[model samples]
Structure formats: C-alpha cells, structure tokens
Target: MEPSNKINFSRRSFLKTSALASGGMLIGFNLFNACKQDVKMPVDLSTLNYNDFNAFIKISPEGKVTIFAPNPEIGQGVKTSMPMLIAEELDVLWDDVYVVQAPLDTENYTRQLAGGSQSLRLAWEPLRQTGATAKQMLVNAAAAKWGVNASECKAKQGVITNANGETLGYGDVVLEAAQLEVPENVTLKKPEDFTIIGQGTANVDIDEIITGKPLFGLDYKEEGMLYASVLRPPAFGQVLDTFDASEAKAMPGVVDVITIGDKAKAYLESEKPNWTAQLSKSKKVVVLAKTTWDAFKGKKAIRATWKEESALESTEFHNEKLNEILEGSKFNTRRKDGDVKKAFAQADKVLERTYEAPFLPHNTLEPMNFFADVNDEKVRLVGPVQTPEDAAKTVAALLGRNIEDITVEMTRMGGGFGRRLYGDFVYEAAEISDKIKKPIKMVSSREDDMTTGVYRPSTKYKIAASIKNGKVTGYHLKEACINGNMYGLIPNFFPAAAIENYQVDTANYKSNITTGAWRAPYTNFLASAEQSFFDELAEELGVDRVQLHMDLLENVKNNPDPKIEYSPDRLQGVLKLVVEKANWGKTAEGTYQGLAVYYCHNTHVAEVADIEMNNGVPTVKKVTCAVDCGIVVNPLGALNQIKGGVLDGIGHAMYSDFVFDNGVPQSNNFNSYQLIRMGQTPKVDVHFVKNNIAPTGLGEPTLPPVGGAVANAIYKATGQRLTKQPYMNNLQAKKVVG
Candidate 1:
C-alpha cells in the first residue's frame, strides 16, 4: 500500500497514550513559536491507531505494551533508563514491552529536547505514574472479569494472579481494561515493591548499538530514495552572489538542485538577539541524486561566490572591554542581602581576574541529517532529531498545509550534546521535499555539519573578591553574556537557584555566525569560571577550594536566598562525596590534582581530576566522579554518559574550538577541530550516591567541572596556573598571568 503524500492527523493523534517508546525518554516541540494547537490524534501506530487512549499506555489484545517517551535518547542511554520507570510499576519482564519511537505530537510529548540533564528528572514521576496507573487499570478489568475485588489481584511480570490460584496474562484483560474508566487517581507503587527501578540494569540498546542496527538517521534508507547534499557558505554570512544548477544537475544520478535557507517574510519581534541573515542561516544548495556518490559529485562541482561582510568582533576585543567595565564594579543586576561594597572597601586584600573562552561546536558523532517525504497530499519526516513536533509544524507551514497533515518519525541520534535539539536542520529536509516535489534524504557533510552549525557562545567572566582574616569579605561576578538571548531555551522555566550579586550583561557583536546549545550550554562556561575562580581564591588564602565551597555553602544554607536556588541537598552531597571518595589531601608523591563540583540538568556531579605533565603537555590520568540522580536505572548507561561528558570536557579543555580570523574560521573539520581520542581517554570511575529521592539527570552536569579540575591539577603539578583552555597555546599566557 502506498502512503498518501499527505499525513493524516488522525493517525498522528492516535499514538498519544504513554507506552514503551523505544525504551528512551523523548521531548517534542513545534517549529514556530506563535503556533498554538489542540491535542491531535494519529490514526496509525506500527500502521495501527494506538494513541487515543491516554498520555502513557497502549495495551495490546495479546498483552504487549508500548510506551511513548517524549525525549530523544541521543546515546545518553534513555533507551533503557526511562523505560525502567514504567516497567517498575507494570510488573512486567522488561522484554515484554515493545519500544517504539514516539511520533511527533506535542500535546502528548514532554519537553522533547534531551539537554540540561532533565531527562530522568522530568520523566521520573510522570512515567512512574503512567506505569502504575496502567497496571491498576488492567487489574480493575481483571477483577471485574473474575468477580473479585481489585485488591485480590496481584500483577507480576505479564500475568495477573489471584489468591485463588487463577491467573491470566495481560493480553486476556487489555481489551476489557480499555473499556473501563480510568480512575481519577491511581495509587502508584512503593519503592519496596519496585523490582526494576532503583536497581542496576544494563542498557537495553547496548546490543543494538554493538550490532550496528540502523537506528540512527544516517542508517535510515529507502528503496528508490534519492540522496541529497548541500554546499554551505565559506564563512558565516558569506552570501551566494550567483550559482547555476545546469551542469551539476546533469551529473550522473543527480536528480535536482535546490537552494535552501531561512526566508523571513518579515522581521517579527523575537527575544533572540544576534539574529542575522547569515550564510549559515539555514541556506544551502540541496543536491539530489540517485546515490551518495552521485550527490557528492553534484555538490563538489557547485560554484558560488561568498560575500564579504563584517564578522564578529575579536575575542580579545570583547575580553578587554568586559574587563574594563567590570573594574568599575557597577553591578546591581542581582544582589543578595549584603554590604559587599563596604566589606570589599575595608578588606586588606583585593584580588580579581578575567576568564574568557571562544565559541565551540558540538561535533556529535552522527552529523545532521533528516529524511522527509512530501507529496501533494501529506508530509512525513524521519531522522535522528531532538525535535519532531517542531519539524512537523515546520513542514506543515512550509507546505502551506495544516500542522495535522505532517508526520515526524524520530530515529535514534548518535549524540545530542545539545546540537540536535535545534529543529532548523529538520526544516532543511522538509524544504527540499517541498521544493523538489519528491521524497528526498538530506545529509550534511562533516564540513557542513561543523562550520555551518550553531555553537556555544564564547564568553568572558570577570570575578573579584575581598579577603579579610583569610575569609572572603566580599565577592561579585560580572559576566559579559555575548548573546542577549540564550534565555529562550528554557523548557519549564520553574524552580530557583542560589548565588547573587551577579550581573550577566549581554552585548551583541552579531557577526555572520550562528549559535545554539552545547551540553550544559552557558553553565559549562559559568561552572569553569565560577568554580575555577573559587579554586584560585582558595589557593590565595592557603585554603582548599573544596573546603571554601563547603564554607560558602554553609553560609548559603543558613541564609537560603531565592536568586540562586540550587538543590541544597545535592550541593552538599557532591562536595562531601568527592572529598571522601577521592581520598582528598592524600599523598601522591609529586602529583597535583584539582577538584570542582556543579549541579545542572537536575543532577549534581563532583569531579576530581588527577593531572601530571608529560613533555610539557597536560595529561589527565584519572577522573573520580560522585554522581547523584536519586536512583539507578541502568548503571552502565549512566556511567557511559558520565564518561562521555568527561571526554567531551577534556576535548574542550585541550583541543576543541575554531580559530577565527577576519570573520572566517580557520578550522572547519575534525582534523582542525580536536576531539578527544582513545589514547587520551582517562580512567573514569563513577559512583552514584545512595539516596531514596527521585533520580535527576546525568548527561551534562558531569561536564562543567572537568575543565576546572584539569586547570587546578595543572596548577598543582607545575606551580603554575593555567587559566585558558587548549592548554598548549594558552600555557604561556597563563604562566605570565600567574
């Protein structure tokens, strides 16, 4: 049967109920910000209508259950952990649940972007309830069938057994269970009764990944499907003066050539500052061909002129400007109750320093790619994307059809690192199908994937503290937030944090550059700056940085302020654990190490990085992390996330970043962009703290501290302070500054 070029909303809306969604937690968002929509139902799930039942359950007549998680896995191992939540209450063997990736429908989806470590933090409660409630519903149906009270039934694995020795599989009760009214509120399972949650389990997808299943978008294929490639700008904002599709389009297997980019009908009001019509602004030549090589040939032969434009101001320029401004100490941005000025004025010693970092890319293993099938009737998209609802809405709007007419199928992403969350790349695929009037697969080359992608905004942090009697009398942090609008990335914008007297003054030096999230986003910079500065100050006062943080934390705890409301329990937990676990202050002969702790993505992680120099190059030999996410779903998966974050941070510390000159990046591919390799892989040991509380997230919170840890370790090993990253070139500057 041929699918209509048009997607039916009936099927999209039908897949709404919660079930085992490919064993991973997923998040979903529509493309446009102003679009408001009612909940929709899809007509088919696995080619059958499945989602109209509720937010989290689909029971088969034969007893199998499907879960619909709203967030992307992105190799963080949600494919195993998130499912453990529902499986705990469902009382089913994990194998009994069939996991399918949720279709893109926002109403039933959670915050679909899998960043900020909120995957388990946000999904833990809802998913657990979904499981328990579904079980209770099934029990209610079974009770009615057996003429027994629901309390007489007990669910174990996939069967319901009564005290009378009668038993029936879930398949026997699901049809009747669906007809029963869902109770107003179903009592969830207690921890004591949980067999799956709070217990160690291996990742469900490990076998799949090892076997090389075609779960990722790059692995997706279709018969007679044409491949497409795009030629991007030389640098950001380097516009195409002219180009011809004639010669390249005639190449072997080349089907069509299309120019793709963001076409803003009008500059409507948006909080997003630093917005520019850039060469990197989603514009490209879509190369359509019969094979990947054919697409490559057409892409290689394309010729275009890159327009000269004013690039972003130099990092040095902004660094100096921010330093000068902070020296004036004009910060009222957010302050706690303190006479910090008077304290600083009376102090016998005053110290301050400026820290800065350049923009960096999230070079995920799997580059950006998406497949969209659009005909005159309906639109369907499949790829490894963090955003499905967003992609669907984009295709619908671009196709001039209703949002309900688009279908988005999310495939497993190789890695997110906060890059795949941007739905812009998905729009690239939809635009090609709409233009070429045929189903097409769009793939970005490694070059296009890196240089053309958005990045973590480079930032400069200035901090000062006044010391008296070996104690900090006054402290303030003035951060020059480069882009004025990284605030729009919030998923639920609730909760509060600690820290005060901090002014994040943003200035836009909008160049032809594009920017997006990378890991913890701004928190990575903030953690390195704030935590590293604390370490420096501790050394100045002849105190341990870990001890100093504990002291400050004590003060914060006693006076709990609203401006910066971090998890009090977590803050204290990681600090103590790291110190104890790493055998802090223990002798290691001549080895010097540094420590840092940070809480983000609902999880708190503290790392101790042991460092030693090998031929003047900083080498990290060991990393000890104390992670607390409440409970363990898949210990191995959680460990993998922590290890990945550390390696990623190591890359950022020693060999990641674009060398910009005259508005163009000197380094564009992996050869120039240094990522961590196996030779440098440190011994990473992760220990999750024992707690009965809910599990948070483990993806990104573990990253921020690795930089500070290494920086501190370098200082210990060489009686030198290294303030900058890519430890080679900046070593000179850091030594001079010290």
Candidate 2:
C-alpha cells in the first residue's frame, strides 16, 4: 500500500534553522522525524540564528526562493521536479523559485543517489511537509506582526494576507520568521489546488543545456589541474602485468607516468563483497599530461602487457554455458506454488519458448570522467555521479582518509543510465591525485568506456506453460544469466500469483566480465521476454491478446497475494487506459499493432507499438504509452522521460548488441555499434493515469515495456517470433512472411 502524505504535526520536531547572512530566512527540518512518536526538544531558534543550517529553502530579501534539490539529477528531471514539491506547498509562484543541486550532505539529505527511480517516490511526503512547514512559519510571523490569529492569515505566492487585507511579502517578515518557532504541522495543498505541479514546467537546466554551458563533467576544469588517461587490461580475465612508460614520459606535454591500484588489488583480494570493489581494476597505468590530447597521446605511446588470470570468456562461451544451464535440471527454485508436477502431467497441451539477449554496454552520450583533488587538508571531488555517497565512501577507503574529510559536488550528468553509479572513474581520479599530490581530471575515451566499463548481464529465459481445458493450468519459468539472476529481486512480480500452479527456477554461470545495473536492469529484457511469451500464449490458447491480459489481471485482483510486488488495480488501470487511448485491435491498412503492460520500479506502464512493413521489414511508426506513476510532478519532464525511454527501449532492442571475442569487446565504438537515429525514431504518444496517490518513479518503468510492445508488433507484422535481442538481426536471419 502507498504511504499517506498527510503530515502528523504533534509527533514532528524541527531540526535546525538560521537567519541568512543576506537578511533572509533558512529552515532545515527532517521530514522523517514525523514518523517518530517521541518528539525531540526543538533547538532554540533565537540562539541558532547563524547561517550554517543544512537548509533546503533560502528566502532572499527580494522574496525569491532558492530551493536546494537534494538528489542527483541525471537528466531525470529531479533537479526541476523535486523542488516543485516544495514550491507547491510553499505557495510560491514557479517563476519566483530557483532550483540548485545540493552538495553531498548525508546530514541534510537521504537517498542522494539516482538509481532505482525511487527519488520522487521516497521524497513525496517529507519534501512536501518541509515546504508546508516553512509556509506555516511565515504565516505565524505575519500573524504576529498584524496582531491577528495565525489561522486568520493565509500565504500564497510568497505573500501573507491577513483578514483585514493587509499584505506582507515573505521577504518582509524573513527575520521574524527565522526567529519564530517552527509550527509542528502545516496543511498540505490538495492535488486539485496544485498550480506548479501537474502543470507543464520547463526543465530548470534546459537553457544551460541548450546553450552549451559547462554543466557536464567533461566541461569541468580547474587551474593547474592535470589531465589523466589510464590504460587498463584489454580483457576481463586479464590483469595488468607490467608496462614501460619511458617512451610515453618523453611525449610532448607529458608531466608524469605512474602506476596505481595496488591498494585496490589488496581490497579485492580480501574477499570483501562491495559494489565499488567490483568496479575497481586491480592495476592501471596513468599518463598525466598538460592537456587532454597530450594525455591521450601519451597513453597511446605506453606499451603494456597483461597476464591471463582466468578463462577469457566470450559471447559464444556465455551462450553455451547459459544454454547448458537452462537445459540441465540442477537449478535453485526461487518460488513454488501448488503442484506443478501434477498440473503439467494432467495438462492436455504444453507450450514452451526460450528468449535470449546479449550483453549490452551503457553507451552513455558522455564518456566517463571525474575531477578530484586530494590534499592533506581535504579531498575535493566533483563530477557527474549517480551515487555520490558511495563514491565518497569508496574514495575515503582508498585514500585512507575519513569520509568526513571528503566533499563531493555533483555536476549535471550527460547521461548515467546506471553507468556513473559505479564511480570507478571517480576512484581512479582520487587515487591518481593522492599519488601525485596534485589535482587531476580522469577521462575515458569512448573505446575505453565501452570496452572496460561495467555492462548489462546477458541472459536467457525459458518459459513453459501447461494448458488444460483451454486454460493455463501450470506455468514454469527458468532464467539463466551471466554473473547473477533476478530471482531475489522480482520473484513475486507479475505472473507469480496470477497462475494457479506457478514455479520460478533460476541458475547462473559466473563469468569474469563485470555486469551491473543498466537502466531498468533485469526487467529491461525480462519484460520483453515475458510480454512476447504472453502474446504467443494468447495465440496458442486462441484468445485475444488484450483479453488474456485482462483475465490474468482479474485473477490477481480476485485472489490478491500479499507478497505480490505489483498492484492489480494499478496494472489493470494502465492496460485499460492504453487500450482505449491507442484504439487497440484497430489499425490502419498498413499498420499492425501489439500491446504490452508491466509494473516495475514502483510504476505501472502500458505500451502499444504500431508497426508497418517497409520493404519486407517491420518498421515502428508510432508508440502509444500509458503510465500510472501516481501524480505527475512536471508534465513536460514526465513527457520527455516517457518519449526518451520509449525510443531508448526500441532502439536497444532493435540494434544495440554487445558481444565479446575471448573477453575483448567487439563493438567498442559507434562505427561497429548501432543506435537509433532521429529518422528511425517513432512518434510516442504518452498519457498518464490521473491519481492523487504519492508520485512514483518514471525514469525506468516506461522503458521496460517498449521492447515487448515492439517485438510483439513485429511478430504481428511478420508472423515470426523474435526470441533474441537486436531484433533486427534475428528478423533478418529468418524469412519475413508477410
């Protein structure tokens, strides 16, 4: 169940507050404190009138409000939308507010990271309450000056008006508000009353982004900072053995050549499981130079030899191992319900299919880069990172310094997509700086980023279903992947409780290739496989595809499982909404349509892809999507996310393929790799399910369903099942029956 957004005032206590140096007010409070019954003693606002509070809001003397957005903005629009939550309750005009990225402050913020799409979902209540409480404090101050009951005064658009119609700007009573005791509770604005939210607001960084401002990590620079280009092992199972840097040291503008990562190697050898540890390369050769070009040139001059430490695994090897695992019965059962053996034995017919996907690189627009200055006093790190707290912790551990001694500043990321979450580049920058005792900016070429960066795990799923009396009696799903499986995370997702006899088994073949989250993670491919399987299932049962989904959802709703990870009502809502919006089952003469619905990252999304045959090839023309992520914070940003995700999902499923030859990446650059171009992008029509429930994530949920919709649509147009990713490749390999 979704948590209530209603604020409980009696149990809440303000944390800190201060009068701004610029003759304004600053308020800091922990919204989570409302959950605690025992209220802590409020700090004396009068004594703590200094400008050092970890405050979210700063009201200037001119009535302008600067809201510090506390989450990393990786083009997810949190920098703009998160502050909207505060400004909405603060009763400030959207134009009167300015949003700024907050620094990494564990004391003042929670969940500063940007993965999992949980930013807005987790911040919904507390951020609203923070703004509401500040508004109430302003109201109290105005009421005190006017000699009227605080309840008689109402605040709107940064102004307070009393019963007699006298008005005081928020700036006018800033000092008094700073001295006033924080109100334990404040009334929040209803959904219908929201003016800034639910309305289309331009992204806060749109101007800077379009104007080519220095907002990305690649644009960050400091005087006297050296540039670094590192050479790592060419393959996954290889380790850096030795390197001769004399020739590189003699290159033009080359400052120094150093080797680092001994400490990282020791840490990895300790057998301690850590996300950062998995990212760290045990040894590397860094070429520090006066310029980025010089660094690159020097790096090219270095001759390094690597020693094989383990099997040099390739894509063919991965495919063999995965297929072997799926074919074998030695599997760990993730979930089992009812009697699968009996149901299958008594079944009249059985249908089974396997879906396969290759490993994928993040391929972020901006290659990995970071700036770090490690001095005896403190460590200053600045870059675009999804997980600043984790990066800081990793740097502190590597440098043998206290985490408090490190400060991290987040720049707007060009694109993360879970790549920057690892912070491998950040560690390298800090390690290089600590070794040379000078600030350094570490940058990775596109080849370096693609060949050596962490990747999305390759996976295969075998789904089997038993049919009796034209109804699915038993369902079994087995997943085989490289490095890890999704059983622990999504065992109770859709299709778990919908079927009477359901069982999920998972097995994995551990490889030396590093794999981590990529966008929606497992669901990015799982949804495609599951949705395509459902379409095939519908055909096998001689039922309408949409009707089959409705039946399964109805089963889930009627016999609700407490452990089910999705809301049947919500899932059904999007499915029905999309069906109506997209005019499902009705298409033009040349257009064939297919639909898919999925729930993940706390959001429910439904998509319908419209495809047309062009020269015996299925081409996507348009995509209609419906999303239920609770209340829409910024319609414009929400629309951007939907469209971007749809296009990204379609492009990757149709073209993005990453393979390895003996652990060496075959597609390192765009010359060999393929991406969807503007001409190929389909028109995406996005609609949202109107609700007052607290907002959920939108960044990733919209992506996971698009691949399924596209694949199913291709099947409808070509009469061929696409069981492999890079659907274009698979489609071309098979005859197109139109």
Backbone Cα, N, C clashes tallied per candidate:
53, 0
TM-scores for candidates 1 onward, in order: 0.87, 0.95
Q: For model 2, how does the per-residue alpha-carbon lDDT over 55-135 read when each residue is reduced to its tens digit?
A: 357788789998766678899998988888889998999999988776786544445688888888877777788788888
* Residue 104, model 2, lDDT: 80
- Give the CA lDDT, 0 to 100, for residue 326 in model 1: 53
Could you give candidate 1's per-residue lDDT for residues 3-28 as a string of tens digits?
12222222122222322332211111
The prediction achieving the highest lDDT against the true structure is 2
Worst 10 residues of 1 by lDDT: 26-35
Error of 2 at 496 (Å): 1.8
> In model 1, where do residues sit more than 4 Å from their true spots?
1-55, 244-247, 262-283, 309-339, 488-508, 733-738
> What's the lDDT for residue 729 in model 1?
55
Whole-model lDDT values for every prediction = 0.67, 0.85
